[model samples]
Target chain A: MSVIEIKNLTRDYGGKGVFDLTLSVESGETFGFLGPNGAGKTTAIRHLTGFLKPQKGSCAVNGLDCWAESPKIHGSLGYLPGEIAFFDDMTGLDFLNFIAEYRRVKDKTRMRSLLERFELDARGKIKKMSKGMKQKVGITAAFMHDPAALILDEPTSGLDPLMQSRFIELILEENKRGKTILMSSHMFEEVERTCRRVAIIKNGRLATVDSIDKLKAAQVKKYVITLENEKAALAFAKEFAEEDVSETRVTVSIAGNIRELISQMNKYPVAGISMPGQSLEEIFMQYYGGNKNV
Target chain B: MFNATLFKSGIKGGIKTLALFCAVLTMYYLIIVQMFDPALGKMVQELAAAMPELMAIFGMNLNSATLTGFLASYLYGFIIIMFPMIFSILSVNRLIVRHVDGGSLVFLVAAPIKRRDVAFTQMTVILSGLLALTLYVSVLGIVASEISFPGELETGKFILLNLGALALHMFIAGICFLSACIFNETKYSVGIGAGIPVLGFIIQMLSNSGEKLEGFKYATFFSLFSTDGLIAMRPNAVWGMVALFFCAIALFISAIAVFTKKDLHI
Candidate 1:
C-alpha cells in the first residue's frame, strides 16, 4: 500500500500552481521529486504535509485525508521544509526540545544519536548559526521523532559537501529501517544516489516518472577527444558532424552506439580522451526540452 | 483545543512586553491615587473649567468629588484605554502575525497539533496577557487607594470600572487578533490591527472636543465604554459591556475558523 498519495490535486494561483498533479509513494521505498525552482515541487509537498488545502482533488497519508486529518497524519510523518526558518531567539537545542515536547517524544535516545551523527553543536542561537549549521539542526529536528514516513524538501541545499554526504548516509540508514521517504530536489547527483524511482516535474506538470537505472541507461554520454593536430580534429568533427570543435579538441555525444564511436575513433590519432559527468540539465534538454506535450 | 507547548512559548514571547505595561500601569495608578485630595480636586476642577474644551477632549468632564470619580476622570478616560489598546495591538501582532509573517509558524503547525488548536493557543495567550494586566491594575488601584486614604475609595464602583475597561480591551484585542489571522504579511496585520483602534481614539477625541462634533462619537467603538457612566452605575453601561464581550467572542471564533481553513503559503 502507498504510504503517501496525491491524486489529481489542483490549486491554481493565477498561472503558477500545480494542476491535476498525481503521485504516490509506497511504503519503505525512497521516491524522488525532481524539479527546478518554481516548478510546484514545494506546492505539491505542502499538500502532502497538509499546509495547503487542495482545491480540486485530494491528498492522503496512511489512508487519512491530508487536509482534514492532518494532525493524525502528522503523528507518523516527519517533514523538513525547503526554507528553514527557526525561532531566532532560541538556541538550536531549545528549538529541538520544543519540537520534541510538542511531539510527545519521551525517548531522547534517537534525538541524541542524530545530533551526534551530524556533529551538530546545538548550543548556539539559531540566528547566529551558519546556513549549513541551521540545515543540520533542521535535519535533526525532522528525524528526531523516528517517524514512519519522511518528506524532505531540498533537504541538503545549504550543507557543505561533508555534511551533504553525511545526510545521504542518514537517508540510506532510514531507508534501511523500512521508512517511507519522499525527497524533492533539483540536484541530480543526490537524487541519483538515494532514490530508486524519480518523477520529474516541469511548469507544475509531471514530465516523466521512471526508474533511475532506466534514465541512466538512456543518458547521453559526451566524450571530448584531443587529437594530434587541428587537422585531425577538424577531420573527426566533419566525420561525426560534431559542432563543438576547437583547435585540436573535438567533443562528441553518444546516445547508445559506443561501438560505432570506437570504430570511428580508431581511424584518427587520439592524443587524449576525457568524459565529463552527465548532468540532469543535459538530459532535460535532450528529452523534455522544447516539447510541451511530453 | 489547546497545545500547551505553543501556549507556553507564546506567553514566554510576550511576557516582557506585558511586564513593561504592567509596571507603567502600576506607577500611573499609584501616582494618580495619591493626588486625590479635596483641595487639589477643587483646584483641578477650576483649571478644567477654564480650559473646558481641552479637558473635555481628554474625557476629563467627570465630577471629581470622590476618589472613585477622581480616578475615573483622570485615569479611565485616556490613559487606561489608550495604554491597554496599545498593549493589545503590540502583543497580538507579536503572538500571531509575527510568527506567520516570519515563517516560524510552519514549525508549530507542522507538528501534531491542529491548525485551530494553534490559533486557539495564540488567542489564549493574548487573553491571558490582557487579563493579567487588568488584574494587576485592579489590585494596585485598591491597595494604593487603601494605603493613601484608608476607606476613601469606593471599591465596588472601582471594580465595575475595571471590569468595563477589561471588556473594552478584550474587544480591542479581538480586532487585532482578527487582523493578524486574516493577513499573512506583518505590515497589513499591523496596519489594520493598529489602524482601527488608533483611528477610533482620534474620532472619540474629536467628538469629545465640543457639542457640535457629538455625532462623531457614533463612528468609534471607544465611545461605548463610557467611563463616567460605568462609574455611576448606569444600566446602559452594563449592556454595552455585554455587547462588547459577545462581539469579542464572535471575533475570536471567526479568527480560529479562518486560520483553520486558510492555505498557508509558508
Candidate 2:
C-alpha cells in the first residue's frame, strides 16, 4: 500500500504553485523528487506534510487525509523543511529536548546516537552555529522520533561533502529498515546513488516519473578521445560520423551498447580516452529543450 | 487541546517583558497611592480650575476627597489602560505572529499536534500573561493602599475597578490576537495589532478633552470602562464589563477559527 499519496493537488499562487499534481510513494520505497528552483517541489511536499491545503484536490499519508487528519497522520511522519529555521535563543540540545518533550519521546537512545553519527556538538547555541551545523540539528530533529515515513526537502543543502555522504548512508540505512522516504534535491549524483525511482517536476507540472535505471539507459553518454595525431582523429571522427572533431581530439556520443565503440577504438592508436561524466541535468535539459533556466 | 511544553516555552519567552511592565506599574501605583491627601485634592481642584483643558485632557477629576475617587481619576484615567494595552499588543504579537512569520511554527505543527491546538495554546499564553499583569497590579494596589492609609481605601470599589480594567485589557488582547491570526507577516500583525487600540485611546482622549467631543466617547471601546462611573457604583460600569468580556470571548473564538483554517505560507 502507498504510505504517501497526493491526488490532483492544486494550489495556484499566480501561476507559481503546483497544478493538478498527483504522485504516490509506496511503503518501504525510496523516491526522489528532482526539480530546479521555483518548480513546486516544496509546494507538493508541504501539501503532504499538511502545511498547505489543496485548492481543488486532496492529499493523504498512511490512509489519512493530509489536511483534515494532519494531527493523526503526523504520528508516523517526519518532515525536514527546505529552509531551516530554529529558535535562535535556544541551544541545539535545548531545542532537541523541547521537540522530544512535545513528541513524547521517552527514550533518548536514538537521539543520542544520531547526534554522535552527525558529529554535531549540540550544546552550543543555535544562533552561534554555522549554516551546516544548523542543518545537522534539523536533520536530527526530523529523525529523532524514528517515524515510519520521512519527507526531506533539500536535506543536504548546507553540508560539506563528508556530511553529505554521511546523510546518504543514513538514508540508505533507513531505507533498509523498511522506512518510506521521499527526498527532493538539486544534486543528481545524490539522487542517482540513493533513489530507486525519480520524478522530475518542471514549472509546477510533472515532467516524468521513471526508474533511475531506465533514465540512465536513455541518457546519451559523451566520450572525448585524444588521438596521437590530427590525421588519426579525422579518421576516427569520419568512422564514427562525429562532427565535434578538433586537431587531435574527437568527441563521440554513444547512446547504445559500448561494445561497438570498444572494437572501433581498438583499431585506432588512441593516446587517451576520457569519458565526461553524464549528469541528470543533461537528461533534464533534453526535456527542457536546452533551456538554461534550469 | 493544550500542550504544556509549548505553553511553558511561551511563558518563558514573555516573562521578562511581563516583569518589566509589572515593575513600572508597581512604581506608578506606589507613587500615586502615597501622593493621596485631602489637602492635595483641593490643590488639584484649584489647579484644574486654572487649567481646565489640561486636566480634562488627562481625564483627571480630583474634586472628590475619597481615596477611591482620587485613585480612580488619577490611575484609571490613562495609566492603567495604556500599560495593559501595550502589554497585550507586545505579548500577542510575540505569541503568534513572531512564530509564524519567522517560520518556527512549522516545528510545532509538524509534530503530532493539531493547528487548532497550537493556536489555542498560544492564545492561552497571551491570556495568562495578561492575567498575571492584572493580578500583580491588583495585589500591589491593595497592599500599597492598606499599608499607607489603613481602612481609608474603598476595598470593594477598588476591586471592581481593577476587574473592569482587566475586562477592558482582555478585549484589547482579543483585538491584538485577531490581527495576529489574520496576518502572516510580522509587519502587518504589529501594524494592525497596535494600531487599533492606540487609535481607540486617541479617540477616548479626544472625547474626554471637551464637552463638544463628549459624543466621541461612544465611538471607542475604551469609553466602555468609565472609571468615575465605576467608582460611583453606576450600573453602566457593570454592563460595560459584561459587554467587554463577551466581546473578548467572541474575538478569541474567531481568532482560533481563522487560524485553524487559514493557509500558512510558512
Candidate 3:
C-alpha cells in the first residue's frame, strides 16, 4: 500500500522556477529520492511535512492530508531534515528527553540504546559535540518516536564509515518493522545498498522511478576488450552487433543477453577484457542534468 | 500541559536579564554612595533642582540627590525597563530567527505543538521571568531604601509605587512580544519592539520639557507607571492602573491572534 501519495504537488514561493514537484513513496519500502542541490528535494520534503501548503494538487501522508491534518499526521511520522540545528545550551540527554516529553511518550530505554549504538554521550552539551555527533542526535530524535513513516533527507551526510553502517542497519531494521522511508541522499552506494526502489528527480520534476533491477536493465552497460590479434578483433566486431568499434580495443553497449556478446568476444584473440557494472552513481550522473555536485 | 514549558522558558529568560540589571544597579549604587565627596552635596542639590520630570522616567529623582535616589533614578528610568525590553527582543529573536537559522524550528513545527501554543509558551516564559525580577527588585529596593534613607522612606508607599512601575514594564514587554509574533523577520520584530519603547522614552523627555503635547503621554506605557505620580499617593491613579492591566491583556491576546494567522517561516 502507498503510505505517501503526492498527486501533482506544486508549491510556489513567489520565486521563478521552483515548486512544480511531484513524487510518492510506498509503505514498508526504502524509496530513495535522488537529486542535486536546489533540485527541490528539500522543498518537496517541506511540502510533504506540511511546512508549506501546496499551491496545486495534494499531498497526503498515509491517508491524512498534509495541510488539513498536519498535527495528527506529524504524530505518526519521523522527519530528519538535511541540516539540523540544535539547542546548544541543552545536554544531549536533556534535549532528547524534552522531545520525548513533548511527544507525550516515555521510552528512555530505547533512547539510551540509540545513544549507545550511535556512540553519543548523553551528558555532553550539544554545543560541545562535533557536527557528526549533532547529526547523530538528530537521527536519534527522529527515530525516538518510532513512527510508522520516516522522511530522512541526507541522513548520513556527516557520519564516519562505522557510524554510517550502523545507521544503515538501523534504517533496515525500521523498514523491516514496516516503517515507510523516503530518503533523499547524494550517496548512491548507500541508496543502492539499502533502498529497494529509487526516484530520480531533475530540475524539480520527476525524471524516473524504477526498481534497482529495472534501472540496471534500462541503463547502458559498457564492456571493454584488449585483443591479441587485430584481425580477430575486427572479425569479432564484424560478427557482433556492437557500435563504437576500434582497432585493438573495443567497447560494446549491451541492453540484454550479454552472454552472446561475451561468447563472441571470447572467440577473438582477446588478451584482457573489462565490463564495468552499472552503478547508481552513473545513473544519477546521466539524469542529473547540470548540477555536477550530484 | 503548555504552562509548564512556558513557565520554564519564561523564568529562564527573565533570570538572565535580571542578573544583568542587578549587576549594573549594584555598581551604580556603590559608586554613588562611597565615592562622592560630601562637599559635592551643594553642587548635587543645585543639579537636582534643574532636573526635569523627563529624567524621572529612568527612576532618577534629583530631589533626593543621595546614593539611593541616584540608584533609583537609573533603575527606574532605563535599567529595569531595558532589562525586559532587551529580554523580549533577544528571546523573540531567538524564537523567530535562531530557530529558523538553526533548523530546529522545522522539527518543532513538525511536532504535535500548534503554532499558537508555541507562541503562548514563549510569551509566558518571558513574562514570568520579568515578573520574578520585578518582584526581586521591589524587595531589594525596600531593603536599600531602608538602609540608604534610614527613616525618611515610607516602605508601604514605596512598594506600591514600585509595583505600579513593574506593571507598566509588563505592558511594554507585552507589546514587544506581540511585535515579534506579528513579524516573521527577526530584525523587523526587534526593530519595532526596541524602537517603540525608546521612542516613548524620547517623548517622555519632550513632555518633561513642558510642551503641551500630553497626547504623547497616552502612547507611552511608562506614563501609566509614572513613579512621581504614583509616589504622590493620590486617590485617582486608578485609571492608570486599570489602563496598564488592560493593555497587558489586550497585547497578549493580540499576540496569540497574530501567531495563529502568521506563517511559521522557520
Pick the winner on DockQ between candidates 1 and 3. Answer: 1
Model 3 DockQ reads 0.45
lDDT of 2 at B173: 94
Off by over 4 Å in 2: A221-281, A287-294
Each candidate: chain B TM-score:
0.97, 0.96, 0.79
Model 3 bad stretches (over 4 Å): A15-22, A221-294, B1-17, B26-45, B50-74, B94-97, B206-221, B234-238
For each candidate in the order shown, give its overall lDDT on alpha carbons.
0.88, 0.88, 0.71
Per-prediction DockQ comes to 0.69, 0.65, 0.45
Q: Write candidate 1's Cα lDDT for A75-181 as tens digits.
A: 88999999988889899999999999988888889889988988999998998999989988989888999999999999998998888999999999999999999
Per-residue lDDT tens digits of candidate 2, residues B1-266?
A: 89999999999988999999999999999999999986777888888889887887877876346888888888888999899998898888777887789988889899899888898899899899888988888889889989998987888899898889989999999999999999999889889988999998998888888888889889998878988888778999889988999999999999999999988877
Tens-digit lDDT string for candidate 1 (B140-163): 999999999999888999999999
**Candidates in descending DockQ order:** 1, 2, 3
- The local lDDT score (0 to 100) that residue B156 gets in candidate 2 is 88
DockQ of 2: 0.65
Candidate 1 chain A weakest lDDT stretch, 10 residues? A285-294
Q: Ten-residue segment with the worst summed lDDT in candidate 3 chain B? A: B63-72
Calculate model 2's interface RMSD in Å.
Answer: 0.8
lDDT of model number 1 = 0.88
